[model samples]
Target: MREPAKSKAARTIEVINRLAKAYPEAQCELNFANPLELLIATILSARCTDRQVNVVTARLFKKYRSPDDYAQSDPSDLELDLKSLGLYRNKAKSIQSCCRRLIELHGGQVPRTAAELMQLGGVGRKTANVVLGNAFNINDGIAVDTHVARLAGRLGLSAHKLPEKIEADLKKLVPQEKWTLFSHWLIWHGRRRCYARHPDCLHCEVNDLCPSAFRFD
Candidate 1:
């Protein structure tokens, strides 16, 4: 007979223990000095790597240190500055619009709440969560990125596919204080071990607790 499913609490504890031991220093990989920089980086990170975002932002951050700088920048120049990233034109527009709103509404500062942050042009639930968690140290909700979503499914922490539903499921399973860290752990694990096409299950630290382990073997 097939074994009974593990209790949500039990599974969560097991998963957390293994991942925590494996990646004690797991955190957001995107480099940013402040909330505004983080907000801009997260927006530019859509369908892009954190390394690329950091490389671009190193110069972008120096050039546009304040919301007013971005708000007043020439769109063409901004697009040219971000030409290295995919979807540069759209990202530039979003950044310009978001900064303008920031200046108009929050007086050139990043908003502290998800609701308000989402009101910005390029900001969404994921970006808002990243900023709130890392920049503001608020564990409002988990940022369900591609890595988190994939690992959540593989680990059986969440059966849902959509980010919103997956985040909801994760919220129920993970502790409130760990919301932010949980996303980071999963993201780190996904990037390091649980690849999309071929997961390194044999040497994976959470293999024992992971139901999908060694399916390739």
Candidate 2:
């Protein structure tokens, strides 16, 4: 008699369960008090760490509390305020443009659906997914950042290189209720353990279940 082959869904569930236990307190690290704030934060998070985004938003959020503020803001002034973050000029433009659309289309509130949110300037699928999942508690799709994409391939959860394809692969394996938390867990783990280089697999919590575990060792 041979051992049974583990189904992809079963393997994913086991991985999720272990990760949930390992990171019981895992959540979105980006600080935001509202959907609009989260939307802005996510846009600024491109090529920037959550810590860096939070630092800039601390003052930025205080200065611009509403979509109207951003819509009314001077582009040069906004760029100056966001100078600390790389690509400040483009990000500032997107923020202002997105806010303008919010004011003109949605009355200055972040849209709840992914489709509506994506229509805003600078709000791509990844950013829209982040706002939808973390801010609105709507699991429209998994937020596939660099970390998620890397972990998905390493853990054999997804072979797709593109975030959208990876997100689709993950959505099929992980349960809908766990979609939001699943992304969070992978992100937290990627930052802490399964790093892009020099992963510390010696103490990885899910090493036993991870097919790519210790490949670097």
Give all TM-scores, in the order shown: 0.96, 0.97
The local distance difference test score of model 2 is: 0.92
The regions of model 2 sitting more than 4 angstroms off are 1-5
Each prediction's whole-model lDDT (CA) = 0.92, 0.92
The TM-score obtained by model 1 is 0.96
Residue 138 in candidate 2, Cα distance off native in Å: 0.9
TM-score of 2: 0.97
What tens digits encode model 1's per-residue C-alpha lDDT throughout 82-201?
A: 999999999999999999999899988888999999999988899999999999999999999999999898888889989999999999989999999999999899889999899999
Q: lDDT for model 1, on a 0 to 1 scale?
A: 0.92
In candidate 2, how many clashes are counted? 0
Q: Per-residue alpha-carbon lDDT of model 2 for 1-217, expressed as tens digits? A: 9878678789899999999999999999999999888999999999989999999999999999999899898999999999999999999999989999998899887889989998999999999989989998898899999999999999999888999999999999999988899999999999999999988899999887788999996
